[model samples]
Target: MADELKLLSTWFSPFGSRVKLALHLKGLSYEYVEEEDLMNKSQLLLESNPVHKKVPVLFHRGKALCESMVIVDYIEEAFADAGPPLLPSDPYERAVARFWVAFIETKLVEPWFKMLDGTRARAEMADGVKQMLAAVATLEGALAQCAKGRPFFGGDGVGYVDVALGGLLVWVRASEVLLGGVKFIDAARTPLLAAWADRLAALDAAKAALPDFGRVIKHAMMRRGAAAAALAQSN
Candidate 1:
């Protein structure tokens, strides 16, 4: 425990998934502690991330690291020589990747999560889905430019932006079924993203890191139900 790295996570969270992806890509071995229930917070979690009290808290060498992206960032820097570099060597390219990562969070991630948490009304939720698709369309363009005929956003191999968004692939796929087959990463509209999703999914790190599709869908459905009930009561 003193010398080893530990990750506190829930099985179905994309935030946790991304951190796991980064760790796996780096070939890092970590102890994963599954938090079965968020409502009943674990002592380790509370101590690890008191400010956010959220999952995806990573403990390295007896110290705690909070937030998923922050943890990913830390993993990349701390374990730079452990595996392939997630960010590019050039500062400009790294900046570009970081920008896209920000876009993924503000545009795609926020909207998708708003719908997931049932924080919005029915009409608002529909609008949220629209926002998500719009972000996907934007990322489609970003991918074409960034990839330059390569297979990934980072080119050839998985890069920072790829790990950032790739973590959400399972949820994105689940959202299609949740939306009655509405395609967020449409082959027709966002062909790059559609293909990117497939390639990223096929990666060994992705397979090891990502939550199971069926289980994610089931867990999300239950969360949606709870959120809907709460929203209905509030309304």
Candidate 2:
């Protein structure tokens, strides 16, 4: 029987983009339902992910899966026979990939968003940015160990870790622009990660899954302005 798949997503969400990239990499066909307003979520989304009420909810044959990375893992297992493997075949290697994916999703993402939102004071924001960069540097070291001579963290092709981080690279670039040309990932500081970001952005799956860079920058600029206004009012 053919799989009946539906994805609840938002275009600007990096989490949603992770699921999209995973689906693309697995060559899976799924109906995409965009949640236009996250605040006023659809009944489908609320029912699908009642706990989190978040985007990137995947419905497979009427069973809904919440959380972006969890959905990606489910897609990999469900469509294991269809396309290139998103995870390594070896058990140890697969565990390593899973670890890094978790690390990226949990450790790096929050600080990056905080930095982008400008919610912290200047000193605290600087510290948060430093912590975020330190996390990226750690991942850069991991990439160096795992990538060998290959272009991606998964060695030759995009893998679980790549999907986890690649989706956010667009926002990182946009945030950099919004921060007055501050370069977060550069050759001088995080060369491996900087280069990996470029490679990931150029992938066909990434190109298809990622939203328009211009739109991302415009949205980020508006957020930056709003954040600045809020900060000023608070002072």
Give the top-scoring candidate (TM-score).
1
Task: For candidate 1, give the lDDT of residue 17.
Answer: 86
Candidate 1 accuracy as lDDT: 0.83
lDDT of 2 at 116: 57
The residue pairs found clashing in candidate 1 are none
Per the 3 Å backbone cut-off, how many clashing residue pairs does candidate 2 have?
0
lDDT of each: 0.83, 0.78
Tell me the TM-score of each prediction against the true structure. Answer: 0.93, 0.90
Per-candidate RMSD, Å = 3.7, 4.3
What is residue 173's positional error in candidate 1, in angstroms? 0.9
lDDT of 2: 0.78
